[model samples]
Target chain A: MTEKIARFFAENRPATPCLVVDLDVVARNYDRLSGALPDAKIYYAVKANPAPEILRLLTGLGSSFDTASVPEIEDCLAAGATPDRISYGNTIKKAADIRRAYELGVRLFAFDSEAELEKIAANAPGSRVFCRILTSGEGADWPLSRKFGCDPEMARDLLLRAAALDVVPYGVSFHVGSQQRDLAQWDAALSTTAAIFRDLEEKGVALRMVNMGGGFPTRYRTDVPGTDEYGFAIDEALRRHFGNRIPETIVEPGRGMVGDAGIIQSEVVLISRKSANDLRRWVYLDIGKFGGLAETMDEAIQYPIETERDGGPAEPVILAGPTCDSADVLYERAEYRLPVDLRIGDRVAIRATGAYTTSYSAVNFNGFAPLQAYYI
Target chain B: MTEKIARFFAENRPATPCLVVDLDVVARNYDRLSGALPDAKIYYAVKANPAPEILRLLTGLGSSFDTASVPEIEDCLAAGATPDRISYGNTIKKAADIRRAYELGVRLFAFDSEAELEKIAANAPGSRVFCRILTSGEGADWPLSRKFGCDPEMARDLLLRAAALDVVPYGVSFHVGSQQRDLAQWDAALSTTAAIFRDLEEKGVALRMVNMGGGFPTRYRTDVPGTDEYGFAIDEALRRHFGNRIPETIVEPGRGMVGDAGIIQSEVVLISRKSANDLRRWVYLDIGKFGGLAETMDEAIQYPIETERDGGPAEPVILAGPTCDSADVLYERAEYRLPVDLRIGDRVAIRATGAYTTSYSAVNFNGFAPLQAYYI
Candidate 1:
C-alpha cells in the first residue's frame, strides 16, 4: 500500500471492508503513462473508478475521458472536462443515450456494428466514429470476449459506411485485453488495424486515427514490465506497421491508470476447519465477490493479501467473503497462504484493488452495504 | 408470464430494464409450500428478494425469516417480524454482528464451527443454535460449495460443545442445493443429519429441531416438480429418519419462494453479427449480469425469455448486456434463440427473475441505474 493510505489507516482507523485510494499514486501513474506515450492522448476509462477526486485530478492534468454511458460523460463534464475531450466508448448503447450524448456536444463515439452505426448516424449527426475490431485477447490476466468488437472486415465496412452516413470515419480501435502482460499482443492487434486502414484507404476512405484500447499491465501477485518497456514495444510496432505515416493515436487505460492506487482493508470474521483432520482453514472476511472483489469471480485476478501478523508461520487457507452464497468464496483453488496467528478482527490489506472493486460491488445483496470508498 | 405482470407492463409502459413482481404469485407460492409441509415453519430467506412489500406480505402470512446479516435482520424487523421469528442463518458472521443481533433480541442462530459457536455463546448467551452439515449439492442447477457447512461428525461435536457454552443445541441444518431438482437429494442429506442426531442423543445432548435449509426448485426455462412432490419426499425422509418423533422443523426458501413471482422487462439495445458470414446474431439488452441477473455468472441459471415477435422463425443468438466488460455477456454457449425479426427497442421479458435479479444488481457498474422494481 502507498504511504499515504497506510498513514491514513493508522490515524483514522476507518471501518473494515473499506477501500482507500491514494490520489498521489493515481497522479504518479498518470504522469508515468503520459511520459511513456508522449504523443498519444490518454482517455482515462471512467468505468474503472469514477471517484470525483480522481476525475478532477485527471481533468487538471489535461487528460481526456473514455466514458461508458451518458452519466459518465456528465461526470467528466462536471469534473471540468470539456465536451470535446470525452469519448463515448461503449459499443452497446440506446438510441436515446446516443441522442443525449450528441446533445451534450460530445463528438467522438465508438461502435462495432451497422445497427449501432445507424443509430449514431440518426442521433449524433456529424459525430466522429471509431469502429472496434476483434482481438484474440491472448496473454492477459483478464481476457476479453468477442462481445465488444467485430471482425476486421466488418470494421472496415462499417467505417466505410460511416462516410455516407453523415459521420466522419475517424479511426479503428481494438483491445488486446485487460492487464495485458505480453507486449507482442499490441503488435498483433495493430497489424490487423493497419490492414483495415489500408483496405479502407484503397477505397478512397482515409482513416486518420488508431485508438489502441486499454490493456496496459499493473502489478498484482507477479511482476510485469515497466511503462518504458511497453512504450518502446508500442513505438517499434507503430514503426513496423505505419512506416512513418502513423495515425493520431489514443490509448484508453482503465486498470493500468488506477488499479494499483488503492487497497481494501478487511477484517477476519471467522477462521475454522470443517473437520478435526481438515488441513486447510477457512478464513472468512468482511468483503467478498458482491462487496467489491467481483474480479475474483473465477479465482482470476488474485490480489496480494497481507496481514499485520506477518513474519509468522503460515498455512494455505480457503479465503471467503462474509456472505451466504457459496460462490462468495474468493480463492479456493488458488493457494492463498495466511499467517497462522491471524485471529478474528485482525485487519487484512488487499493490494492493487482500485480499478474494478467499487464499481462492480452489488447494491445490497444479502443486506451488505456497498464497499465504502475513501479518496486520500 | 403472469397475467398481472403482463397487464401492469402494458398499462404502465414503465421504462426498460425494470422488474415487476406480482405479490399474488408470491402469496400463492407461500400457501402452496405451507400446504405441502403442514407442520414445518417457513423461514423465508431474506436474501432472495428483500422487498419491503414481499417481507410485509410474508410477515402477515405468519412466516419466519432466515436472515443472512444484521441489516437483513433489521429489514425483517422493519417489516413487522418479531425478533423471535427471525433466525441468523449465515454461518460466516462477525462477532460484533452477533452482539448486535443479540441486542436486537434475536435468540436463534446458525453455525458450522466451534469458533462461531463460541462467538454466539459470548455475544448472545442462552440462545439456540443449529449446526450446518456439508451436503454434496448434487442434481442442482445452482449447486452450492462447501463454504458454509462442516462434516456431520464435526457438527455433532460442535452441537455437543454448545450444550456447555450457555447456548442451546437447537438442531442440525443442511442444504441439498439451490434450484434442486432431485427429490431424492433431501433423503440423502437427512440420512446424514439423522446419524448426527442419533450420535448426539447417545452422548446425552438431544437436539430438538431439524433446520432443513432451502433447496426447493423453481420453474425456469424448463419444468420442475411441484411443491407437493417435494413435500412428499421430505415427509417420507423425516419418517424414515426419526420415526414418529419428528422434531420441530424449519425450511428456508429463497429462490423457490419468489423466483416465479417476478419478471424483468428489458429492451433490446443492439443486434449484430461478427461478420457477413456469421450465423449467430448477438443480442444486446439494457439489463445484464451486473444489472441484476448475476446468477448467469457461468450460465448456471437460465431465465426463460419472451418477446413480442416470438411466433416467427428464430435462430440461436449470443446474448449480452450493455456493458463494456466482456464478462457481461449472458449466454454464449447456451442455445438461447431469439426471433429473427427482433428489432431494437423491442421489449423482452425475462421470467423467474423476481428472487435474485433486483437483489443481485450492481450499485452502478457502467453508469447504469440499479434495476428498478415495481411490486403490485
Candidate 2:
C-alpha cells in the first residue's frame, strides 16, 4: 500500500471496508499518460469509476469522457465537463436513450450492429457515429468475447450507411479488451482498422478518427508494461500501418488511468479452518463480491493486498466476502496467500482498486453498506 | 407471467428493464407457508429483497424479519417491525456492526464461528444466539459450499462457549442451501440437528429452539415441491426425532417467500447473430447480471421468461445483458428459446424474480439505471 493511503486510513480511522482514493495519485497518473502519448486524445472511460470527484478532477485536467449511458454523460456534465467532450461509447443502446443522448447534445456515438445503426439514424440524425470492429482480444487479462464489435466488412458497410443517412461517419473504434497486456494486440487492432480505413476510402467515405478503445493494462497481480512502452508500441503500430495518414487518435483508458490511484481498506471479519481436517484457512473479509469488489469475479483482476503483518509467514487462505451467497468467495480457485498472524480488525489494503470497485458494488445486497468512497 | 404483473407494466408504461412485484402474490405465498406449517414461525429474509415496500407489506401481514445487517434492521423498523421480531441471520458480522445491531434492540442472532460468537458476546451480552451446523447442501439449484456453516462438533462447542460467555444458547440452525431440492437432503440436515440436539442435551444445555433454516426451494426452471411437501417432511422429521419434546421452530425463508411474488419486465435492447455464420441469435436485455440479475451467475438459477410475441415460432438464443462486460451474458450456457420474431422495444417478463432481483443490483454499473422496483 502507498504510504499516503495507509496514512489516510490510519489517521481518519474512517469506516472499515471503505475505498480511499488519492486525487494526487490520479493527477500524477493522468499527467504520466498525457506526457507519454502527447498526440493521442484521452477519453477517460467513465464506467471504470463514475465518482463525480474523479470526473471533476479529470475534467479539470481537460480529459474527455467515454460514457456508457446517459447518467454517465450527466455525471460528466455535472462535473463541469462540456457535452462536446463526451462520447456515447456503448454499442448497445435503447432507441429512446439514443434520442435522449442526442437531445442532451451527445453527437458522437458507437454502434456495432445494423439495428443499432438504424436506431441512431432515426433518433440522432446528422450526428457523428463510429462503428466498433471485432478483435480476438488476445493477450488481455480480461479478454472480451464477441460481445461489442462487428466484422471489418460489417464496419465498412455500417460506415457507408452512417454517411448516407446524413450522420457523419466519424471513425472506427475497437477495444483490445480491458487490461490488455501484449503490445502485439495493438498491431492486430490497428491492422484491422487500417483495412477498414482502406475499404471506407474505396467506398468514398474518409474516416477522420481512429478510437483505440481502452484496454491499457494496469499494474495488478501480473507484471505489465508501462504507459511509455504502450505509447511507443501504439506509435510504432500507427506508423507501420497508416504511416502519415493516421487519423485523429482517441485512447479510452479506464483502468490504466485510475486503477493505481485508489486503495480499498477491508477489515478481517473472521479467520477459521473450513473444516477440522481441512488445513486451508478461510479468511472472511467484511467486503466481498457485492461490497465493491465484483472485478474479483473469476479472479480475472487480482488486486495486490497489503496487511500490517505482511512480513510474517504466508499461509494459503480462501478469501470470501461477508455476503451469505456462496459465490461471494473471492480467492478460492486462484489461491491467495496472506499473513497467518492476521486477525480481526486488522486492515487489509486492496491496492489499485480505484477504477472499478466503487461503481460495481451491489446496491445494499444483504443490507451491507454501499462502498463508502473517501477521496484524499 | 401473472395477469396483474403484465397489466401493471402495460398500463403504467414504466421504463424498460424494471421489476414489478405483486404484493398480493407475496401475501398469498406467505399465507400458504404459514397455513401449511403452523408450528414454525416465519422470519422473512430481508437480504433477499430488502425493498421497504415488501418489508412493510410483510410487516403488515404480521411476518417477522430475518435481517443480515444493521441496515436491514433499520429498514425493518422503518417498515414498522418491532426489534424483537428481527433475527440477525448472517454468521459473519463486524464487531462494530454487532454492537450497532444490539443497540438497535436486535437480540436474536446467528453465528457459525467462535470469533463471531465472541464479538456477539462482547457487544450484545445475554443475546439469544443460534449456532449454524454444516451440511453438504447437496441437490440444490444454488448449492452452497461450506461458507456459512460450521461442523456439528464445532457448533456444539460454540453453543457451549456462547453460554459460557453469558450469551443465551437459544437455538441451533442449519440451512440445506438456497433453492434446495431432494427432500432427502432435509432428512440428512434434520438428522444432523437431532444428533447435535442429543449431544447438547448430554452436555446439560437443552436447546429451546430449532431453526430448520431456509432452503425451501423456489420454482424457477425446474419443478419444485410446494410448501406443503416441505412442511410435511419437516413435520415428519421432527416427529420421528423429538416427538412431543419439540422446541420452538423458526423458518428463515428468503427466496421461498417472495420468489413467486414478482416478475421483471425488461426490454429487448438488441437482437443480433453472434457472427456472420453463427447460428444462434443473441438477445440482449436492458437488465443483466449487473442490473439485478446476479443470481443468474454461472446459470445456477434459470428464470423462466415470457415475451409479448410468445406465439411466434421458438428459436434458441443466447440471452445477454446490456452492460459492456462480456461476462454479463446471462444464459449462454443454458440456452433460452425465445420467440423467433422478437424485436427491439419488445418486453420480456422474467418470472419468479422478486426475492433476489431488486436487492442484488449493481450500484449504477456502466451508468445503467439500477433495477427500478414497482410494488402492486
lDDT of 2 by residue, B1-376 (tens): 6788778877899986888888898888899999878999999988888888889999999999888888889999999999999999888888888899999999999998888889999999989999988888888788587888888888888888777887899988988889988888777877888788888889998889988878887799879998899889888888887777888999989899889888888889999763467688888899999999998988889999998789879999989899878778899879789988898988888999988887788889998868988988
The regions of model 2 sitting more than 4 angstroms off are none
- Report the Cα lDDT for candidate 2: 0.87
Model 2 Cα lDDT, one tens digit per residue, A149-192: 88788788778888878689999999888898889989888998
Q: What's model 2's lDDT at B334? A: 91
Q: Please list the residue runs of candidate 1 whose C-alpha ends up more than 4 Å from where it truly belongs after superposition.
A: none
Predictions in order: lDDT: 0.93, 0.87
Backbone clashes for every candidate come to 0, 1
lDDT of 2 at B368: 81
